[model samples]
Target: MSDRELRPLRSIRITGDGRCLFRSVAYGACLRRGKHPPSDSAQKELADELRAKVADEFVKRRGDTEWFLEGNFENYVRQMRKPHAWGGEPELFMCSHVLRMPITVYMYTSSSDGPRIIAEYGQEYGKDDPVRVLYDGYGHYDALQPSVVRTQSRL
Candidate 1:
């Protein structure tokens, strides 16, 4: 379908106004990193397909909004298919923001220490944690969508 046909979901980074967030995110991948990725010999094709389909749906449903595809897919794939040395990290859980969004949406990478950050901040922090520390504590992606993420992560 045409880009215009795509719809935009509510999203933004409060810290930057409309300067930071993205319309949507590839959360499924975020939850499935390390376990599933485009580099895995068994899951490469499936993961790629899923990623593409998700991207298509994202574009179709929320393409109208400001968005960006940020994930460790490229690296994940490389680490998975090296023929010998196979190792790679999962998709990042934090530190991703689309140019048009209002609040930051971070999937929390390993270095960020998601669980610790969550415990220190609480779910509310995930929504508007001015410090922007607790992105993972927002109640899985289902309960704490972007709205909640914004409410708590407001800086």
Candidate 2:
């Protein structure tokens, strides 16, 4: 694709302090609200807050979530409430429910393919302007934003 046809995408790097997933979602939430990404301190605060809410959400919907959880549901929720606990696919799904918005996860593929959508959550909340995030295969997530490109006027 030509430069003019290609849309520039920017990824906001999230801290990998076991809270990357929450930070990424928080950053994307800000972007979705048409606001600038928060400062690092603010991102951390938001992430922790979101993490707490997600843990609570799991409890609130335990009947539906318990079966899919790998371990004892009570213990799982207890551990997930810890700030250092890493979040994975199940938490991502709970995040969607807690935020009441859809989330779209993209991953980088071969250079030729660029980035592609690997998973999506919260479709029941509607599909418009889902919070976008990039997942590095190893276990990190970053917020994605569509950059605005300005064209120069040719003489």
Candidate 3:
């Protein structure tokens, strides 16, 4: 999509804790389901839950994932299961599998370029709708929502 078409995205900042990725995904999942984002405590709990699920997914798909995983598969899964563990691309991919939904990651560029898609996961599951998240190019991630545009009606 063109920059203009995608300009409606509004980012919801997530806590900068190590679980930011999982928290962003959890927030996006809520918005994808047409629900409001949860409270901070709830989000934290949800993030931890998702983290555990992603680790389980890694184990469940170890036959397919082991080769690409860094270090021993057992160690990787063990680290990912930790509540405060930082998540990255590998966890994002597994999040898609665990949630059974597509995830579209975006990064904001210069003013002229606006926000652009950085990576997308789980397209095989479905592409019609994807949970959107914004990556700040550092280690942090935030949930994105399409801004609602209301047109003024003339009296």
**lDDT per model vs. reference:** 0.27, 0.88, 0.87
Per-residue lDDT tens digits for candidate 3, residues 23-102, read: 99999898888888888998999999999999989989999999988999999899888887888999999999999899
Worst 10 residues of 3 by lDDT: 1-10
* TM-score between model 1 and native: 0.23
Tens-place lDDT per residue, model 2, 67-120, is: 999889999999999998989899999999999989989899887355677999
Clash counts for the predictions, in order = 25, 0, 0
List candidate 2 segments past 4 Å from native. 1-6, 151-155
What TM-score, computed on C-alpha atoms, does each candidate reach?
0.23, 0.90, 0.91
Q: lDDT of model 3 at residue 92? A: 95
Clashing pairs in 2: none
Per-residue lDDT of model 1, residues 34-69, tens digit only: 232122232334433333343334444443322343
Candidate with top TM-score is 3
